[model samples]
Target: MKNIVAAVLAGVLSLSLTGCSVFQTLEGQTEDKPNEYSNVYELSSGKAYVWEHDGETDIRNDLSQDRVGDPVFFACPLGDINFKGDELSDIDQYPRSIWIPSDIDDQIPTVTSKNALIYISDTTVPEEIIFERFADYGYSIGVSNMEADGGGHYFITYAETDEDDYKYYVDMKSEAAQVTEFDTIARLYLDKVGGMEVNEDTVSDGGTVMNLEKDKSYICEFYTGTFYQDFKLKANIHSFGKLERFVCHDYEFLHANCIKIEIPDWFKSGYYFVQGVGLFRYVTDEDLLSYNGKAFDPGINWNDPIKQYDEYGVCIFDPSLDIDYEDIENISDPGLDESEIVIGASPEEEEETEGSEIDESSEGSTLDSDSN
Candidate 1:
């Protein structure tokens, strides 16, 4: 899950909050906001939310030749780990479309068009932060210059180079080089990163995995489109002993019935990370209604890199709990296919006999899984 503080610690600049469901951006926190960002406005939990002031600021609308003040970039806490108020409850937690734990290892393994790590700086800092955190991911980043209303420099431009073909920072109170995590709602907006091509291949199935032990029961939540889905999955020390089940989905964040995970031999008994696919676009309720099954980015196998973790965390070991897999399955809607058949796999791989055809009948068919 993408938390306000977790993202900062991971050094990832770009982020997306809850969609239509639970998408509440904090507005007024005068006392809590840091003075460094000019105290324009504040956000709870240090969430990276974009905002705008009155119509007449120094901000310039790249879409139009309008003038205004620069947008406010709320510089949140970098090392916060506390969940306030409603976040303490599972139902009230902000819904993260893709709930993969933010993972950045020391060595840069591989960087594909599948995903790119973005880093933006609020204040002027060393360029080494970008190199150490994001550059090696095959993403070329550079800064440009823009004009601020006041004497302060506003650097926002796109200078493409042969080797490094990407832009990184844009600032308001620019002393020199500047980068930001927040983009204005009215002015130029840059979403998505790198040269990755976004198409139907970006949207597909969804599933997530967690580590568990036998003799333990768990409560899991999957949210989407203003719906908070909560269900139970338990395992005893016997045939269950923390069974790892993989549920398939048609769209990311689809609802599900109380379907217990059924783990097979090859799937193993360790921490299981299940995910359907990666959708590059935001899925609203209206878009879901018109889906004709032609759009989706059939992604990687669930067991490609091993275990997955998130700050939202796994639910288990609560004494005030009583539920069984069978009982939960009865209440849960039937799940999609429980196998690792991927859509984007090569034609030869798709020809496999088992787990071949997808089960699209299940309502809770897809999920936004962040498999690292």
Candidate 2:
């Protein structure tokens, strides 16, 4: 009877151990589950926090409050804009509103309304170094001009950033206007290149660069207004590896505050090589001008033969409009037979052509034998 009792006790102990193992497995799985709020944070008054499992509790109140003094931080919300400090006010001074032209050729309608902010602050480097780098990257600074607006003096500066870079108009009136104009232009250029449209109503304030993949990413931020109720502009320029994103908000900021203007794309890609390399002269080289020494010739190859012209009858430089070199050659030459152009043909057509040739040869041989 004692031995039988011992066996039963051992069996019970074994079952208990197995049950404990199963419980541990489940607990391990639960522990390994992903956290959804890994990248989020919160702020109340001046305190900031990192979101954990128990909701927003203070992570540290002792963090430096210098960032709060910055105008960029003041224009943006705490959680919406990312910074390296705790202070909400010490952020950089960027512009808050801008104005763009109402319309440009195949491009979407230019933004004429005032809806942007700008901040102008010196970078960690010198101005000469920055200007040199800008020029090296296929961007050039043309002019520096100042004007009086809104009872204050505003200065505008222009720089080219890339090979197909769009124009950037910097407003140096105040830190707010400067930053606002920069963000607006950056966002506008980015939208133009990425082929994305901004839903004006859904725009928000603050800059957020989201990592969609290990290498692929996008930047979304409020180009105008405060972080809470601002128009948001998002750009995914990294998707196309070679292109840089340009975003802009206001055009009047360029016209009124701008000290310089970058040449339009049509002139840079289509006309620059054809014409001589004079900076100020290229600015006045309009496509509609008569062929005098003062203006560009109308009959010259001024327009891009490859791109489809826009509503204003201007050539658009979209990579999606790229065609085969042979097809472009055929289109360029008037004497070539369009039917003989082997551009983007299907494999089935190639096979059909071969079969037709064979059939024709066979029929010719049969007819010859019958005649003999």
- Residues 1-372 of candidate 1: C-alpha lDDT, one tens digit per residue: 569688674443332432322223333323543412312222232232222233434222211333234533322122111122322222312211111111211111111122111112234222121000000111011212122324321222233232111122221222111223223222221211222221223211111121233324444332222243343433221110111222322121112111111222222112221211111121223333453322121221112212221111212211113222334234333452324323223223344432334443232345323231
The TM-score leader among the candidates is 1
Q: How many times do residue backbones clash in model 1?
A: 38
What CA RMSD would you report for each candidate? 27.9, 26.7
Q: Residue 287 of model 2: what lDDT?
A: 32
lDDT top scorer: 2
Compute each candidate's TM-score over C-alphas.
0.19, 0.16
Candidate 1's C-alpha runs over 4 A off are: 1-87, 96-192, 199-322, 328-372
Which ranges in model 2 have alpha carbons more than 4 Å from their true place? 1-372
